[model samples]
Target: AALIVCVLVLELIVRQFPAFVIELTVWGLHKEIENKEVNVADKEAEAKHQQHLARFCRK
Candidate 1:
């Protein structure tokens, strides 16, 4: 009886382990995408500031 119980527990953990890993992977991907967007926005703001400064100096 104890052996059977152990087998059941092992099976459950094996089946659920992949699901946990997949969730973590997807969450990590989302965080990475969010960071990438932030970087892009910062670059765009810097570019716009540089353009404005150029135009100001031209005047």
Candidate 2:
């Protein structure tokens, strides 16, 4: 599915540049929260980012 590809791409980015990806993810989440535009898809992506961040951090 498209969603799986998106997640895989994000995971690859995270693996290559974890710090940058984490910063961007945190900024995006903060902006979404501040604007109260937290849609289901946004939440799902945020969750995926967090999951990937955690996985990478354990390395």
Candidate 3:
């Protein structure tokens, strides 16, 4: 009886482990996407500022 209970618990954990890993992977991907968006926004702002400066210099 004890052995059966232990096996059941191990099987439950094994089934749930993949779900946990998938959730963790999705969370990590979300963070990576957010960081990339911030970096892209910063680069765009810098490019716009450089263009403005160039126009001013031309005038």
Candidate 4:
């Protein structure tokens, strides 16, 4: 009986593990995308500033 219970519990954990891993992966991807967007925005702002500096220097 104990062995049967152990097997059932193991099977349950095995079934759940993949879903847990997938959730973690998706969550990580979302965070990475958010960070990438922030970095892109910062780069755009930096480029604009550089353009302004260039225009000022030309005058």
Candidate 5:
């Protein structure tokens, strides 16, 4: 009975393993996309500042 119980537990874990992996993968992708968005925003701000500096120098 102990062996059967162990086997059942193992089987359950194996079944759920794929779902766990998928969740991790989704989380990682979400973080990556968020980082990309932040990077883009930073670049845009930098560009705006550069434009402002250019206008200032034109005076």
Candidate 6:
């Protein structure tokens, strides 16, 4: 639901601004910083910005 939209927005933003992506990764560890990241401190909060992106492996 709303989580999906948030995920999409952050995904796009990270793509456009990679620096923010890194900051977001570490920030996830601290719930307090989550809000500073993007008002996502509680479960009711949007569930975007997952930990891993799951990159593909080509060999």
TM-score of each: 0.55, 0.36, 0.52, 0.53, 0.60, 0.29
Model 3 clashing residue pairs (backbone): none
lDDT of 3 at 34: 97
Query: Which model scores highest in lDDT?
Result: 5
lDDT of 1 by residue, 1-59 (tens): 99999999998878998997898899999999999999999999999999999999999
Question: Which ranges in model 3 have alpha carbons more than 4 Å from their true place?
Answer: 1-21
Ranking according to TM-score, highest score first: 5, 1, 4, 3, 2, 6
Residue 34 CA displacement from its true place in model 5, Å: 0.8
Which pairs of residues clash in candidate 6, taking residues 3 or more apart in a chain or in different chains? Answer: none
- The sequence of per-residue lDDT tens digits that candidate 6 reaches over residues 1-59 is 89999999988886878777668766766756656656435533433323222222221
The all-Cα superposition gives candidate 4 an RMSD in Å to the true structure of 7.0
Q: RMSDs, each prediction?
A: 7.2, 20.3, 7.6, 7.0, 6.4, 20.4
- Badly placed stretches (over 4 Å) of model 2 are 1-38
Distance (Å) between predicted and true CA of 15, model 2?
60
Number of clashes recorded per candidate: 0, 0, 0, 0, 0, 0
Comparing 2 with 4 on TM-score, the higher-scoring candidate is 4
List the lowest-lDDT window of 10 residues for candidate 1.
Answer: 12-21
TM-score, structure 5 vs. true:
0.60
Q: Where does candidate 5 stray beyond 4 Å?
A: 1-16
Error of 5 at 1 (Å): 29
Error of 5 at 3 (Å): 24
